[model samples]
Target chain A: MSTQMLTYLFVGLSFALYVGIAIWSRASSTKDFYVAGGGVHPLVNGMATAADWMSAASFISMAGIISFIGRDGSVYLLGWTGGYVLLALLLAPYLRKFGRFTVPDFIGERYYSQTARIVAVICLIFVSFTYVAGQMRGVGIVFSRFLEVEVSTGVIIGMAVVFMYSVLGGMKGITYTQVAQYCVLIFAYMVPAIFISIMITDNPIPQLGFGSEVNDGSGLSVLQKLDGVLLDLGFSAYTEGSKSTIDVFAITAALMFGTAGLPHVLVRFFTVPKVSDARLSAGYALAFIAILYTTAPAVASFARLNLVDTVHNTAYADAPEWFGNWESTGLIAWQDKNNDGIMQYGAGAALSPIKPSFDGNTGVHGERLLSNQPTESTNEVYIDRDIMVLANPEIAGLPGWVIALVAAGGVAAALSTAAGLLLVISSAISHDLLKKTLLPKITEKQELLYARMAAAVAVCIAGLFGIYPPAFVAQVVAFAFGLAAASLFPALLLGIFSKRANKEGAIAGMLVGLVFTFTYIAYFKFVAPELNNTEHWLWGISPEGIGTIGMLLNFAIAISVSRVTAKPPQSVEELVDNIRIPSGAKAATEH
Target chain B: MNSDEHTKQASDVSQIDNQKNYWKANLKLLAKLLVVWFTVSFGCGIILADWLDQFSVFGFKLGFWFAQQGAIYVFVALIFVYARQMKLLDRQFGVGDENDADQESQS
Candidate 1:
């Protein structure tokens, strides 16, 4: 088939599969809509959770990130996966036993205050929306590449698909569709890794590929060869670590705790049948996720070496058309800086597009090259991390269909996550803010209708914001994690575990946490940039690491406030005990 | 209120004690899990990553590996430990279901 036709074929089939699942799971009642009738098999729930958790950031950008940063990127590797451990051990089971539809529900019930729940709803919305903005952008980027559509047009198309499934079926539809998406994306992720691993190191398994001998026939292992190549290019060795130790520490910790705190992933545990299953399913999710996590570093190593070898120390004046094609999207670019028309790429490029300045020699004069100029590069190597996963098939000269499958996989990842977060956002709006707190008399069916409306409206707003994402995939995602880590996590942890955690204490902690984390991130990411003040940065921590400090403040404030305030109600303490032990709990009935 | 029900209630008190004991067991398991979590992540991975770097394994920095792949593998392993404890809890409490899903769904 023609590439265009084949691309549409794969994307269409995948979309059909998702919508088909959504149709099959139309959710007859509020219970079905919110938590998928709480009957999802542990394994299926695990698969859905994997898809829900991976998001576009994981499937598309993570390895790409690792490949570029070398040893410094280990922070991401540890932080992202380590958080799941926290989720499994600390949060998932108890929440399942709590029999709540949303995280805020638990907060409200535990604190015995509608006000506390509303505060949580606000925090949840801010965090989830910020996170979804990145995924929405991922959808646009992928669609533009595969479907040959404008990025804005792609965003609209993606919004429509998310609206159709997520709005109509809610969590019920999203769960099954996510299961299918998990299969497609993991397959798309692993296939190229396997092929390249075998090609480069004669190891069929990517995990072994990293430690095996490189094809260079130099009797050196892949790591040794990589270190040698990086040194030759004035870059750090592949295996040698260079990130500021403290920063790596803070970032990893923040992300780990953040994962445990994210509402969307935590809520997935509530969909399983029983508390024990919730605990077991969390393990299943991690085990499924670890497969990709384990393989990713090896894939990244292989790709980096292959990329360097392909573009550098070669006679090829031109890479294939895909490089230029993606470059026009402003994701990848090259400049000729030394009045040399040829492109040069490597360490000397000094990271980032040369501010379009490196090539004063190009269309504009006297502009210092901001990005790599292959013309100036002695060994060409201008690469972008976002391209790493997508370009895998092309890098290995795979067929067009495989490349098309990758594009579909990226969309699947973005859409699944967007749907999940949107559901949480919509639920917070209609369930917590509207029916529960604002209007106590709303009918169940009417509330469900409002949820559907919220999903559609949120999609449009999210789509608009997604079309103009303010940060890169990883950075924007960090903001979401930061907000969750600092705010809701503390309230939930304290409310159940500490009998003295009254509504006033919980509310105060959440407000302080939310304000401090958001203000810190906003001040740094947006406000500080506007002020142009490099001297004002405290501790050299970006908006990303600020969450750990914010989380501490939340915990401290909650504990201190509880020390001075009235204890939580006797009934509330009893409820916590009930949540702690399943104790013949009946099926949850959403009202 | 019946004589037989009252006798049953006396036995139920012992069951309540067993539940309390089970809760203690849960707490111990949590403590162990948290310690392992802290050691793998904060100890070898972060707080002492450099200190542990004084030791190396197969040219891999012991601390850095712990911070990265080692910690993650241990994390994956940690989930199973928690699951195993959950099963034991079920056996002691007579609540664990064996039809639960196995954790290996990786493609």
Candidate 2:
């Protein structure tokens, strides 16, 4: 069978499986919809959480980004995973003991104010939407690349699949389907990595192969060879980072805090049966996630080495099949700056505009003619970082089946995360906004109907974002993490840890953190892109790292404000005391 | 009647004291574990990465390995340890899940 046939078969089978689970696990009550009846096994919830947490960015773009940036990429590796430590230690168990339907429920109840819940809802919407847009776009990219369909068609199909499961069976359906997705994505990720590892270093384990010597006659280790090659091409050593230490520190901290704060991830713990289950499941989730995280850097190094070996100084017509295949997808392009008819891969940007603007005509060597002016740099290739993982199998000459599996894996990663985010969005709207605040007297059946309706609308909006992606879709992702870290994380922490944190203090802290982080990011990213570098950044903290400072400010302000404000009521204090214990964590309740 | 009231008051005080002790112990455990977490991730992974990278183990740079791999392993271990210890703590304080139904009935 052709590669396309295999891709269709795998993707079709995955979709059918998801739809089947949705039908089998159709939510009968609000409890089933919201928290999967709050009886999910720890291991199952852990795998589902792994699937939800590893979005298209982790699955598709991370390794490629790491390959380009080298040691600086450790910031992402550490930042994304280290947050789980915070989650397991400080947040998950206590929240589970609270036994609420949504995060805002905790905020509303603990702070004893509707205003606080509204603020949390706003923050959740902002973060989830921004993050979901990326996932939707990822779905579109995978569909277009693998299925030979238009991006919009791909997005619509993805939205339909998500709608079928999430709207039908809610969290129960999403959870089981995500377990399947976790298996598909992890297997897809590992297969090519193992193949490449053996091909490059004679070691089957990508993790060990990363540190082992190159299989070729060169006596150099993989890292040493990578460092040498990158430096020879005028790039920084692959083992050394170019980012300033302070900037790296701040960015890592921001991401760590942000990861711990994300609503979709935190909500997963609520599905487990008990407080200890929450803690145990967080450990399992991280262990599952770490498998891919540890393998990514190794994959990055191997792909970089392979790319350079395969393409550098190679004749345009003789370039590997994967190069041209990706080129047609507009992710890879070439220009003959020296008219040498050979491709040059180097450090600097090949085109002045960074992204290639293809012209209608083909060049003398049949390369795509680009309207982009060639830069003074010797680099003559433009490779989109998102293609690294998807193109890896082809680059290494793996079987067509492996390539097809990668396509399915990418779709699974995107769809699973998208479904999780949409669920949170709908729950915030139906449970928090409508039932809790607006229509408190509504019946449970009415509320469930509204939840499904809200999910349907949210899925459509998400699909629209995928089809007509905003110009800032990529840039706004920083907003999601930044806002979550600066606002929700501090508020939740204070509400749990400090009983004196009244409504006034919690409200003030969230607004201050949200507004401050938003202004800083917008100023640097939109207002003055030229001044976004270290010299102009406040205290050597880039906009990406400003969330760390924002988080600190939130902590300080909340603590001080609570000192001045009236102490929380006695009942609220009792609530805090209750959540601290491990027993009596019944199923998540509407009340 | 006076003696009965006094005994009930005494038990209430003891229960409060037990809860307080449990909280204190939980905090102490968290502090110790968090210190180790900080040492592995921020202290070694970031602050001391360059210094530690001066040494290599089995062709892997020590600090880089910590940043990329070792810290994640430690994080997983920490959570499991926390879960196990918290379970024991729950049992010790008579707040284990098995006692949940009993507590609910009394309430």
Best by DockQ: 2
Q: In angstroms, how far off is A347's CA in candidate 1?
A: 1.9
lDDT (10s digit) by residue, model 2, range A172-284: 99999999999999999999999999999999999999999998989999999999999998899998888888888998999999999999999999898888889999999
lDDT of 2 at B18: 84
In terms of TM-score, how similar is model 1 to the real structure? 0.91
**lDDT per residue as tens, model 1, A276-300:** 7888788889888888887887778
Each candidate's clash count: 15, 0
Interface quality of candidate 1 as DockQ:
0.31
lDDT of 2 by residue, B4-101 (tens): 57886879978778888999989999999999888998888889999999999868789888887788889889989998998899889976676554
True contacts kept of each: 0.39, 0.67
What is the alpha-carbon interface RMSD for each candidate?
5.3, 2.0
Clashes of 2: 0
**Predicted complex 1: CAPRI docking category:** acceptable
